[model samples]
Target: MGMEYEKIHACSNDCLLYQNECEDLDECSVCHESWWKKVRLYGPMYLMWMYLFERYVKILKAYFKNRNRPEGCVMESYIAKEAVEFCSEYLSNAEAIGLQNKVDSDGATVIDFRKIGYKNDPFILATQVKQVFYTTDPNDLELSLVVLMKSRDIRDGEGDADDCNCIPSVSRGLTPVDEVDVFDDDDSNLVRLDVEWTYGTRSGGVNRDGIDYYNNLINELLSNGLEPFVTLFHWDLPQALQDTYGGFLSPKIVDDFKDYAELCYREFGDRVKHWIPINEPHIFTTRGYEYGSFAPGRCSPWLSPDCNGGDSATEPYLVGHNQLLVHAAAVQVYKTKYQNTQKGQIGIALNVPWVVPLSQSIADQEASNRALVFTYDWFMEPLKSGSYPAEMTTYVGERLPKFSEEQSSMLKGSFDFIGLNYYSASYAANGTCKRINPRASTDSCVVHLSERNGTTIGPKAASDWLYIYPKGIEDLLLYTRDKFNNPVVYITENGVDELNNGQLSLNDNIRVNYYADHLSFVQRAIRKGANVRGYFAWSLLDNFEWADGYTVRFGIVYVDYKDGLRRYLKDSAKWFKQFLL
Candidate 1:
């Protein structure tokens, strides 16, 4: 009963549903659902508070003086409507203007914004605790980004709480993997805040200036004894590039990417070991390029997959086919030219959400299998084994794209390593790819669906996408190792999000728990003989998330939007230093 009211008080979950359930004390409502999570980026509390404060005494006096007045008796409904209006405006303001801003003595300012109420708290910012990154700042340069947060992550004096978040039980030897350096479009060590091109006003980094900025940054990183794991693109495609050749689908991109890869390899190959030719190609292909989620935004569910954008109903796989070819050609060049001398290995990074079946029945299982094969296996087999999964052929048909014999040979079994990008988990039902909505559980995400008889459960945290089932990651590792013959695996991305009184909190106990469980999963996979070698947290700091903008934050070190006051260590981050290092 109390939990139900908590929803109303916070304007969380489904308030109407909660109220309906309350009205049916002994019975049930036609519309039955679950309780809500935190307020989305938009909620009604801001207005409610304003209305109550504006004229409480006046309302009381009016009620006594005008008890018989028709309009006086209708104050309650008017107040309710006003509150709703106010909340919409207030939330819109927060997302746009963001939380209060503060400037440090150094004069760097932090821009922080809260996403709407926490519907799927974890989903918007991902919940899988991969490598917990310790980041401070990044200049618009590649090399500087490599070392952006490293020096600052060090604790001062006995590791006592001196502005940095710390863990008493953590040990120096326990950090899972060595910290990574940062990179950017600037050649400097510190990121450019005032400039729109590199920071908030991110213009696609297309010009020679941006490339030089990256080259210099990478050079600095190598000088610092840091091996580079370069992500060629990080949602920073120069608007110029997009305009030049239809972007992703433009045939010209193949040659352009080839040139970029060659340049990256020639200058930094001697030191940089890992390379992700494209970062979350799916994201770039679909969300950023096709739909208007990131930049060059569009809203198509499908279409223009590779070079030309199109609708989701049409298999965007054809366009993706072209992208895969480019990836293969790049790998071939690395092998035939750079590998023997540079002695460096490379792999394409893939983002895969753990998809579970709603039930144990054949239909649900089939759906899960298809989702995996369609989404992940599509990328894996083509790169690792050098062939796309056969199942995809039937589903995608002609929309999938053509592969010549020579191209297949080059593309098939083409990887030196496999990078896994894990985040939230979703469950699918027994239906067609797009038709699984009714059975799929996006709202009741923490509650895994069931087909057999009993309840299907997962771990629950404050996040909506984070069901805290560390076991899922373990399962993911085992699946990857088994499917790919135990190729070297890297956990490339993961994190969580939470809020505090009127502001967000970085205490992040939920995050700590989230990490322990997932890393333990990684450890279990290692013990089980999975060749997992390294991990990198999703982010070093909370930057503007695409489409969603600055709402979702995944940084281990909180970037105080008020001022450029960067403090070190959240609870999970401190714990990670000891337990994982």
Candidate 2:
């Protein structure tokens, strides 16, 4: 169905519903629903896409020719048709009542939803992995090896291991490493450590002390057959670079990023097999530049008053262009300098929501395709075809940045694999583009909605923007396979969130269902021959969420903010343990 039919406004009490009638009402006529609820930012009209017709209703009460006989109006005809259809459906389903009566018994019947239910394991047996490494001595480049022993570690301090003892023996500061034999206990548990190279700590590039720290960390991880998937830059750019020339806005960032990547390759490439040069470039650029909700916040004055000064139309594309260039340069450095010698693979992580066409109409189908072009193909096209999508170039025109032949060549096949972060889906419809005001977000000329026909696309999450749609993961994977030549794809990030409610128990049943359903879709995609390799949940712990702060928790392991940051394995974590077994 077309998204036009989905434009519905209902009173808080569900007493009165409005469709094409009284769309501009400040309050519901019946219950007077809260104005804030009706004017929510996530409403269909204010979404990322541009639409020709506003989704809001334009009431023309004067058009009623027969005010007394309102049933004679054209709008009333559709309501009458719906009533007749409901009656017919009731009559047709009457035969099913016999089956229901037969199925219903006098004895109490148990409805077992345990397979999909969220129930924590009575015993907390799941392992929660944490990073631990030796302290770095600035003077000495060599790392002293040590192993800390902790059976059932429970602490927020320096040396805390999981269920098994694969802990780092050195203290936080410049404490000396206490050598402990860690090879004593080797069991069936798989051990792996995730290490991140320091991008820059507010100052310039990583100093000698930070370099030494990472060197020690990698050495420790490798010593115990624990391989590391090192992420070079996790949206943590040095403040110096940002201050120097607007960081990703200028072309100057490419070389500096290359230098950083080369340094990472030279230092830890031997142990770090998988290198993600940049994590979620789309989020970094769009959120940071266009929306100004993130660090280095910059956006048009109309978009946000908090922004210092930025053109939402131009800066986001510029930032994205620079990110691709920087990523290409980093990959080139790795390929030329370290790939053969270090035996490592490098890729960039990109986040794109699955876009579903709001209607079967050609306009909406085209709009859906354009939405993907602006989001997923915005990066993937450059990486694969050495150019941006034609749809983007056509719609955005000169506003969309371009890559030179050399830059395009470098970007093409720069990655060893594709890292995709999929979470939710939205309905895309043809949007009306206004020449007066254009933006990177609205450049695609499409409108997005999380619901259709007054029914949500999926259940809502704690995050207002996030709607749970597990089928989106499968559809996205298949789309990537068909469109992007079926490259090796790793689900780099996928998870849902919930509000941090202190009144509720630590057991997170919703998260368990989220994982179960999403994983099932991933499995289906794999069965359909999507070259999917790995899947990493968005987070292991409920750490800081970027724009939302600590308001929402996406962690499989819930972190108690009030309780000394103590971690409790949520139902999802226990479910994962049992699932993996």
Candidate 3:
């Protein structure tokens, strides 16, 4: 048929493609094979293989009317087919020979080409398709058909199905694919639940709906043999509180946060033996108050004109100070009123990138230590020693908030454990003091760099800020042991992300390797007596990641956002299952 094509030679064992430099090679480099074999190339099959074109050729061959003039007959038939397809658009009851009518009586069309006789029937309606399944087990007999009919009913109901909770029913069908139990498969006994969503105004009363939902969720988790670790605040301050007193910027937030924490303790503390009063307070303080990139956005006008009017130099310090006070207050209430009766352990989740020196110079080494003092030790020192780091006190000066003697004692040893989120590391070098309009970020007098001398600390992840430095986990744990009096620690949030490029494959081996490497380091840290107690992956499901939104996926379980929000376990999740086993 005069079709253009190119013939490429490849190894019989599929070691490598014979192209470019290897075009003239007679045998495979690795296997030394002489004959052609199945080609293993990257990307979509349509672009790299002949199978699709071969199928099209078969279709074209069927258009031939005469053997003597096969090509001419195909050309004539193809033109007539195209003309009929164009004219069919104007005819109400007519359709092209190969095209089925999309519209049916109920405005829905279902096509079934599996039946032998109906394969070529262009106008097969919804009634013609039988709900069929082949299963040896009696329970699996009607599973797929029932789900299909239920989905159709949901679609037909439109807005009516919005209120229908189908998870319990639909999840039954998923058991055959992956019979995962929280305690059995993942070996996850401790589960973290964010309680910030339940915070409401004192005048308007507690959020009953949120409380009820959590009560059910908590009960269900416990029934599944899982313990709940409740977090009171995860940078989700109530809008009412933020509007009333500028949120964490004002000291007024301390009592309000304390009240909210107490409420949670009263309601759920009995069942929730593990409590985390705040998750990543430093991130909340800097991102929300100084950078103005997060909720209740506020920063120095000079830093960002779009800020909601804030003092970067003072507000970040104030916010951080108040958050510390808030955390202390919550811990005090829990330890005083709830701890004795509930028998619970409380902590705060703090995240910090492990800081390394840019070079071996003393200045860079000291800067790296100073950066840690400013970041990790900023909160840790206060909790352990009842005061901020000396580096922070000297550099930030009057801008840094001081705790009164009474508050200082309350701040000391506030937690039974520390929940640490370590993802990436950065190289720090000594930086010049910003004499003019210095903000909290620059107050450390340390320049943070991902790379030095054109070499990165580690491989980059989908999130530009996240670099894979698995050793950082071990180093950070050891540092925590040495600097913070070896407090019991839980590695709370640690995972990497990949771009959501709509790839269909669930072979997430990179994520598997990431988890394996990081977990191995965690084990090493534990072996070295770092007092690390537990480890939890950052996420279980692909979710709405703040700032980045849905552009990146950090979950081991892949969520098909395009396909009814269905979930499939990636290779990493399977690896985790086996690892835990």
| Top candidate when judged by TM-score against the true structure | 3
**RMSD (Å) of each candidate, 1 decimal:** 22.7, 25.0, 26.9
Writing each residue's lDDT as its tens digit, candidate 1 over 307-361 gives: 2234443324544676787788778888889999998887877877787887688
Q: What residue pairs clash in candidate 2, if any at all?
A: 6-453, 49-446, 50-431, 50-432, 50-446, 51-431, 51-432, 52-432
- TM-score on alpha carbons, each prediction: 0.59, 0.67, 0.68
Encode model 3's per-residue lDDT on 1-581: one tens digit a residue.
11221344344442333223243776323222221111111000111111112223554344334323421100001111121222122221222123222322344322112321223421111000000111112221112112222121222222232221212232222111110112122223555666543222222245454455457657766765556667777665644456556778788888767777887888888898988888898898898788877656678899988777898999888988998999999999999999999999999999989999998999999999999888899998999989999999999999998999999999999999998888999999999999899998999899999998998999999898998998999999999999888898888788888997778556777777777677667656765777766667765666545555456787766766566445566676555554443
Residue 456, candidate 2: how far off, in angstroms? 0.6
Q: What is the lDDT of residue 235 in candidate 2?
A: 60
Clashes of each: 69, 8, 0
How do the candidates rank by TM-score, highest first? 3, 2, 1
lDDT agreement of model 2 with the native: 0.59
- Local distance difference test, each candidate: 0.46, 0.59, 0.62
Off by over 4 Å in 3: 1-188, 197-204
Worst window of 10 by summed lDDT in candidate 3? 124-133
Clashing pairs in 3: none
What is the Å distance of residue 84 in model 1 from its true position? Answer: 46
Tell me the spans in candidate 1 whose CA falls farther than 4 Å from its real position.
1-212, 289-292, 299-309, 432-466, 499-504
